[model samples]
Target: MPDRAPQPVDRQLPTDEARDLIALVRDIVQREIAPRAAEEEEAGLFPREVFRLLSGSGLLALPYASEHGGGDQPYEVYLQVLEELAAARLTVGLGVSVHSLSCHALAGYGTKEQRAEHLPAMLGGGLLGAYCLSEPASGSDAASLRTKAVRDGDDWVLTGTKAWITHGPVADFLTVLARTGGEGARGITAFLVPGDAPGLSAAVPEKKMGMKGSPTAQLHFDGVRVPDSRRIGDEGQGFAIALSALDSGRLGIAACAVGVAQAALDQAVAYATDRTQFGRPIADFQGLRFMLADMATRIEAGRSLYLTAARLRDQGKPFSRQAAMAKLFCTDAAMGVTTDAVQVLGGYGYTQDFPVERYMREAKVLQIVEGTNQIQRMVIARHLAGPETR
Candidate 1:
């Protein structure tokens, strides 16, 4: 049987504007993004034009300030948009999230002049971005990053490589964190470096388990010079800036996890209702029904968790712990739901002929990114009790 398109999610949007925004996004996703997703992903083609379409439609900068060419939507609204995009295609959804993370430092801490000069171009000017915080050496201990930036007469020269960078090869700009002072967290600083800086280059993209259309590569900063004017926040403040971005970025991952799970559940339901066993629809079987029910429940719970975190953020509440919880639970749920989706399809599920296998692979990365689920437990533990003892 030909695959049916996934149904639109029933959403509780806060405002008419938000409702309309989601409608527009769904129209774009269905008309342009969804149909091409499987084929393009199979061919390992990056749909750069899809990102450009999103930028032109004012969807790329939804959570930032309107005065700086952003959509100025609240985090709650913005994250639902991510969920919708992700349900259609994760590359597009997660790419938007990473781009927003790349812009966070400048939008939040850059001088007014810097905002005026760079923010508009970044938010809606069809420019892609990458955030550079991780290195080959420092993944969880981001404080131990070895990338160095030395102050020259008027420019800071950056040296070291950024690993596992999303959009690394294709980004037009990078928000980079590098060490500047003595060892540890307080010594790191953030800078906005043009992607085409003379000494900056990208290594070949990683051969990943899934999401092949999205590039993940190492970026080499070989004494790249960045103007002092492009520095964000104060000196030695990059670590804090990176954390702030991750707190919000975690919510993005959570929403994307829900989307992936939702998509998987949708596929499973569609298949079960159509595929028959013992002279009845398999969905009518109690065991399969229970499995389907559990998948639906988990997806709903994941969506609620991420939205709860986003609302707390929109209300200006401290939501770091909640974000970590959402990231941890939603991603793990996605992994389980997608794996179950494959099981629902029985023999057909494990093949490329079905998307659940792909969803399963894509969902695995959500547990590892933004902060590993293990790290998320530590963050949540610190909030609940106290910092871990040595």
Candidate 2:
């Protein structure tokens, strides 16, 4: 935030172990991520080696079971680590989230044999992953995806395109949702497809407003053959599984939103305290101070909202509605906080000389991804109104 390495987040971690984990994450961010973030992001370079370093450090597996090469930390802890990484660079933090999302189907619903065969390597094997649900025609309406998976001789030939896929071009594995039966949600199914499978290729990464370092592309499965063993859940169960992963994945986006907002707030505060006004520091002015206060308040509220949802998830409670709410509120908060950060720095913020401009650009995509804030509203309203009547 200060251009120099910012201090720790002063988090209220659940355990001493979690505190240590955050410290390690902060150190890594300072050493490996923060310094290179601006330059590499400008160049649109994906740091696969950094991801490997994360895998080797045990940071990649925090939310899963230790029995299967995971760190076994609860969602609460896992999320804060995401926040720290995000503070340094959104690409890395969101990359980790998508990796976890790609792994969710197998971890939550795979056969025990499937879990045994794949979970360990996926959790900590230095493998990058992608989740493919959004398609060219289907965005919020994931059940409408047209990707087809036709059964043949104990294999399924997948054919269609998955759009806006994070890590699509370079992922080592993908958790893909494809149509396996009749129309609508009941027809969908999930598969764990290897990225290198024949006929599975990625289009060029999209030119985007933010997080350019994170490749977002369309994955084409041109009669890509996947063994029956690679299926994550029963046929016609993919939509449900996709929703399940999104419930958790939305939380990851929420945490990343807070991290970005917090980084902006830190930057704004640092700028306000140093830059002189008519006579004294601009931070001494009532208007700027109020803005900073509001920024900090929003960031705190966002952190709380996501953490509450994370705790509910850890406790095995129904948290889908809460997750949507967190994703909605926190990401919107990030958009506002980052915009204000740029405003706080004025012209300097607009220039590439400061990182707040980048933060502002990055905050926008968070609102659109996972689920748009409009979609989140629909989710919350559905929970409250108990679905619309015909």
The TM-scores of all predictions, comma-separated, are 0.99, 0.99
lDDT by residue (tens digit), candidate 1, 323-383: 9999999999999999999999999999888888889999999999989999999999999
List the candidate 2 regions with Cα displacement exceeding 4 Å: 1-3
| Each candidate: RMSD | 1.0, 1.1
- Clash pairs detected, candidate 1: none
lDDT of 2 by residue, 239-339 (tens): 99999999999999999999999988988998899999899999999999999999999999999999999999999999999999999999999999999
TM-score of 1: 0.99
Per-model lDDT: 0.93, 0.93
